[model samples]
Target: MSDGLEFLTVEPASDPVARREIVDLLASCGLDYEKQIEFFVTARQEGRLVACAGFEKGIIKDVAICQTLRGSAISLRLVSEVTYLAHSQGYQILFVYTEPHNADFFLGCGFYPLVEVPGQTALLENTPVGIKNYCASLAHYKVEADKIGCVVANANPFTLGHLYLITEAAKSCDWLHLFIVKEDASLFSYHDRFMLAKEMTKDIPNLTLHGGSKYMVSRATFPAYFFKDKGMVGQCRTAVDLLLFRKYIAPALGVTHRFVGTEPFCDTTRKYNNDMKFWLQEPSSIAHSIEVVELERTKRSGIAVSASEVRRLLAGGNFEKIKEFVPKPTFDLIMNKYATSV
Candidate 1:
């Protein structure tokens, strides 16, 4: 509705300069613009980038506007355009992460704030299924009080390290709720990863598996969390995710303990684990405690066994090397279903 405002969808490949301008604008606003830059909407005033919003799948991120245009309708128009684009692409549920000061603008744009990390970040969603509703559905699967443990994993291809973590966590808790990352944003399909996890862990009697809904480290969280980007962007994303879990998911399931494997490699994951330890500690953040278990080392190479390593082996046609890291079920699936041609 703002006069002299022009809205354009800037593709990173086609309009690299415009994309760089948008990224610079977002970076000036303390937002990360490194990831999910493939498709974005920008508002220009007389050819100057004034406002912008980026989307990846159902997520709306890297939203920014020039300080002078704060009170104008530019933000609303940006949100509307991005939301419409997401809906047109078949995304029924959309999420946006914004700074606390800018919460009201998005709230007016029909997004409800789910959780906020004080001065850091706020998670909001524009959908019929709010956080409360989604958490409530999970409540139905709640176990006995103070006896449950949880593990949120992507299982890009469920590795033996994952199996070891789950098995060890199950040994200490009465019930283990394994939430497989349901976001299909990785090399392996969510279905394949989920099924592989189920098949491998089926023998563990006390382990219960659930899909890591959007509330968990899915599209709702910044994609940077999965990547190598470290610093405030990664920290904020990790904090918001763990905050959501500690506030909504943990309490609902009576989860007294959350378990994660120690990251010897990925700095992003290691920082995430460190943040989890700080955020979930008693009398400060949440009631649940965190356990950082040691990662399983490969039998042959003595390095940490990880999905990334498995993928590397697969890519290099070193299928035999992957058997040391991934579970038998995962190896079978990759060899038979996915890597048959290779």
Candidate 2:
């Protein structure tokens, strides 16, 4: 608020000029503007943008400050303001991905370091005990098994392919843990996906259904997952997401294997499955190796069953075709929810 400094909140969709200015400011500071960044907190000095930070949901991105104001309080003030903006919108917990060298800056702003990919990216959170607390909560559901396997899926509409993967994974391990993606970015809400997963897997006696959290595959852990064409951003976020699981989630429940459906359609998912092998199976000081099991996707009518296909049928009002891909409960729910509209 000094030296002719003024701060303004910007939403890129509403203000293209401000977005361009923010982009140029970030480029000047040697950072690329990331997509899906909904809001920005910018510091303008005498009508010129000097510093900015982007906010999307609970994750902070592309934080940059003018070299002239690097050591000044503007960086701290900028972070504080964006953090306040997140909190005001009901984001109690927040995550930031920054260059490893810049971790100290956020650390000074009440963000605790979580994990770093060294020279690539560093993940930090506002709560020091966030991961620890999440792991501790998971401890209560810890099943006593020598071989525990885990699966993390969005299961957008919980198709037959999902049922096949879970069924096969549960058979291989003594006990299996299923975690549904908590983020509601999908067409199906988190509530609906979770319910569908529960109803489909209720018959498996050794399986334990856990609600998704920030520690799992979420916006905080993997924001790039919700977007396509992110390039290196996808790689960086994938590493952090897998490391969080290998370092914390796996060991907390004695999980030794991660079962994933073999991706046949999306390049993003195929790459993610490959990354899992490196992050989970490769030896590291963080934790023991977890075997990655890639299962073939179930098929119907000579085609691999996929939620995307199911959605396509729903869009066309082809309930008859949709029933071929999804289970009875899923079809019933879809019919009940979309029958009249279709």
Candidate 3:
């Protein structure tokens, strides 16, 4: 299937020459080369780079074949090699995002389309049943309520602000579903974050504290790399994430509203909140109607309480001030972990 082409795998982190060739190829093909890519699979015909694909964790991107070879069988062979390499590294489920027009090419390589942003991008996975199975599992957690509210949070270290937001939001809705971001790319591990959230929200009678999933705000659903224009990246990220939420996650759990704390610190987060409003509740005839509610951030000493502040304080060895920003559970965990040093 290679059509007399030789395939070679290069780890871009160490092979700068190969990486440059890939960057040039992607540029010529009109796709930005993402530095976060771990490796690349290159197809060379007589030692000239004719096709290439990149792998970052479980995501496959930057796939570009020379225009002369676009319709040839080499494209499939290139993707198959990349998929095989990704699976060998223990990534069971692989995802790819491409121009909506190029989605069919990947479909030929066995990727199932999950969602598309019309003219922008299309997301696809290796297995057709991956999202369907996830939604089916979520259906078991559905509860009956006139107004079903939900809050998706990372809660790196559970803060008083988070507790306040969830507590107050729970009050306004008959049932609130709190989903903890499951990706462990934060200062705190997902297990500890989940424990802290569980301990703090235990008293809320009408709320269910659920663990994280890939379908929620995760690296796969919301990539934070590759694009030159950060604004366009934010738009695409929120569109993909929120579309999945409204189309699949919300419907599975009977959720009608999403609650978020007002963002005043992080630009990325503030943009995400704004995009959430546009994506989830835009008055389009084909759009799903999921209300977005932004609650005021809890303040202390005239300053808003935030997890980032807690992290800063912890880093500065100012445990005393961290106590004021976080709940007792988080403070206790911090003290327990840093007892020997502090």
Candidate 4:
């Protein structure tokens, strides 16, 4: 254990350096020591290893890396963190194998027996790794609520600008449902990033967190290959989001308005906003409805607050610049995760 056990937050699957520490953490947690693979790590206050987890790509196995000292419980946190990390990087299920003695540990982590796997040993178990699974059956969908607002942003690391947009939207709405992108397409992993956003705004009244799903923002909906397809993907994504919200979620949940943060610089968001506004407000789009509330920028460091700039600053290691773009908890999580990963 190091001097002042600090829990450093690692970035996403893209980081090269932090990946090494993750390898070591895997070994510490008694897992395979595969190199050139990607994962994330976190530690305790004294800098001792508290908890660490990661996702494997190109394979559907839900099994991951985790280290919880004897008598310590990393259940909810570890499972949720891995689920967020996995889904962000394109994973659907998490599988695990624990010795009979550790069966208690696994069970407490929400693992029920998956006796259907056909193995005589019966070692295979399946566990959900994302909020969509957790909330799909439990989350109360609103259908006729008064003053409903929706906001979506990839808080790569929460910044002050995000706070501004959220606060500004809160001004007119009765409840603010923030949809933080859960996929880790950026420098930070989904769990670390989402947890930051959650911490920062947990104090706000009537504010809820929404984890994005493929049904809403997956390859089937927002394909990444569109990166080279010029602008095909963006328009397609906007259309998918519009269609899904209008056709599926809106009717079940009485949503009257969606809060969109204005992009002063990014062309992608500008276009997304335009298409979104038109589809929601324009009539004849029978069955497609809901008011689009465009949120103005809350200035920070003279530049408009945006998740893009926040990513830019984090990549440059500018902790100071990040302070203005995200919420405090989000900023801290980004700093810790970035520091450890970098």
Candidate 5:
């Protein structure tokens, strides 16, 4: 163990050289490091980046250590510091995705394992907010015999297509929980997107809106889900995320059905839908079986209505075209707030 190391925060934008070094270090460790990280803590030995860990939301990712420092206390200290920072920032829990071999290190550091996929990856968390606590938090909504359904969406700006999906799903269930992605990585802020979703769905009597927990398919749990280029990593992350949902969120909410809009484009989303179907059907994956509902297309010009399309039209100064894809509420919001920027 090295005694001369100092721990400090690394701001990627202000220090480009340190950012490059951290990226290189993570890549050399065979971990995906291209995703945006909000907070990073590093252990420097004489001003050299020896070990580092990143926190995005509540997830600890892109953890890397110099080979010479692997067996020492450096990695443990890095995790401890990052977890402390996360706690101070009001995160009640912290999740980490690490390779299977590194599971023991985190387990020893008080991170209980949630899901381990042999040689692939292990999902672990450190805090009292484990699966049970997460499930317990939502227990008030669970009804004994209600046919509860769920739809998790980013809703960058809620669109007519999203409304159509929710409408269709709501018709089939006694109750529906709509989780707007709380991750603020999209073009529209999470606050705006969530507000749009709530405003659009307010009239639906059976619908209840909830902010997506960090445990959902946010950048924290599935960073690659947002990256179009990293298909393999996206699939792996999606599987882990869905597994967590099946094990924790679904049963807690009494969700017997999961609804999603059909993905006509976006191969990544298509794969996610397929994986949802696969994992939800596995007997051991959940307490009770969940029916994965893929609703049909809501389209114009034979193209599906999507937030990305809305963004494209807004960028092109085609407000009229954007109006055709989005609901009235969303269209009004874009015109009022984003038209001049476009």
Candidate 6:
């Protein structure tokens, strides 16, 4: 086995750093946490309390919950424990909003992705970090006609990488649509994801973020079995979903340029990305797909960081892998959740 980092759990809403970390992680993942869950902590593994994983009490309502720190195997073990605990306590299932990269990982954890819903992306509370109030007052309003860039992220936890994407997208566009997917409706609700996306991207100039209420952010947009059906393999040619989105959602929001990731680890994304290129390349007024590369990872695994890979490591019970992908504050929050589960 790999050398693992110790785990730690914090009291709910305590430890300012830990709480903030959770906020950041969810924001990175695009799940609004402020109004979604009743927080709890799990076991402590290291001298430093890392919030590995946490759970929502009782049965889930149309929302998903965080299960563990990204890329931590111990966290996966902890999530399993929480599953048993929640089940014994009369809980039906432990939910998580995740990217297609980790679909196999979750299946290994015994989580069967729902075919109908895929996973829901939630809107966060009190406006996401960097969004403007221009779009907030209007409920489900479309963006300006003069759109430039777009950030299409699962925003699984709304991290700095997300912020950077928005920051970069806005630099080139007059209007940036930070489309936070209500992806993989798991424990974290769609509202939370949107809200978190808004919060994190709020500061970016010309950046107007919105939630995917129609489920564009979700795997449901493409097909069932997100992980298995991720990027390259799924129904090729026209995503149909993206085309439908271009027909319906874009005009409403006035999205001109659609920004996406250049990360290749996610096979499903690779597939969808091809469709995005094909569609965007057309005579549409929208700019070509803006492909943003990963910020850094110059040292260790030359492979770019990804939510799917992160989930895989976490579900596999690995910790060291997370350190490379997530921030310290974020890592701490996940560890705290792990402690609570144990």
TM-score of every prediction relative to native:
0.84, 0.93, 0.94, 0.56, 0.86, 0.49
lDDT of 5 by residue, 1-342 (tens): 449989988767677888888888888887666456777898899878888898877778788898888888787789889988888899868888888888888888889888765568888989645777768988877766668899999997888889999999999999999999887778888999998998889999998898887788776566666765653453475778787788789888889999998887666777788988977766773457788999986998777898777887888899988878998888888988898886
What number of clashing residue pairs does each candidate have, in the order they appear? 0, 0, 0, 25, 0, 93
Measured by lDDT, the strongest candidate is 2
TM-score, model 1 to reference? 0.84
lDDT of 1 by residue, 1-342 (tens): 438999988776688798779879988887777554567888999989999888877877778888899887787889889988888889878887777988898889999878888888888889646878888899899988556888888888899888888998899889999999887778889999899988988999998899778788875664555554532453586778887888888888888788888777766777778888767763454444555444444344777887777888888988878888887888888988767667
- How high is the CA lDDT of each candidate model? 0.80, 0.88, 0.87, 0.58, 0.82, 0.50
Residue 190, model 2: lDDT of 93
Alpha-carbon lDDT of model 5: 0.82
Candidate 2, 1-342: lDDT as tens digits: 348889889998889899889888888988888767889999999889998989988888888888898888898789889988998999988888888998999999999988888789888999888888989999998988789999999898999999999999999999999999998888788998999999999999999998898877777777667765563554686899899899999889999889998887877778889999998998898889999999889889988998877888888999988989999988898988888987
| Whole-model alpha-carbon lDDT for candidate 2 | 0.88
Whose TM-score is greatest here?
3
- C-alpha RMSD by candidate, in order: 3.2, 1.9, 2.2, 15.0, 3.0, 18.1
Model 6, residue 79: what's the lDDT? 57
lDDT measured at residue 177 in model 2 versus the true structure, 0 to 100: 96
TM-score ranking, best first = 3, 2, 5, 1, 4, 6
Weakest lDDT window of 10 consecutive positions for candidate 2: 226-235
In candidate 6, residue 170 scores what lDDT? Answer: 79
Model 4 CA lDDT for position 238: 58
Answer with 4 or 5, whichever has the higher TM-score: 5
Q: After superposition, how far is residue 198 of candidate 6 from its true place, in Å?
A: 4.0
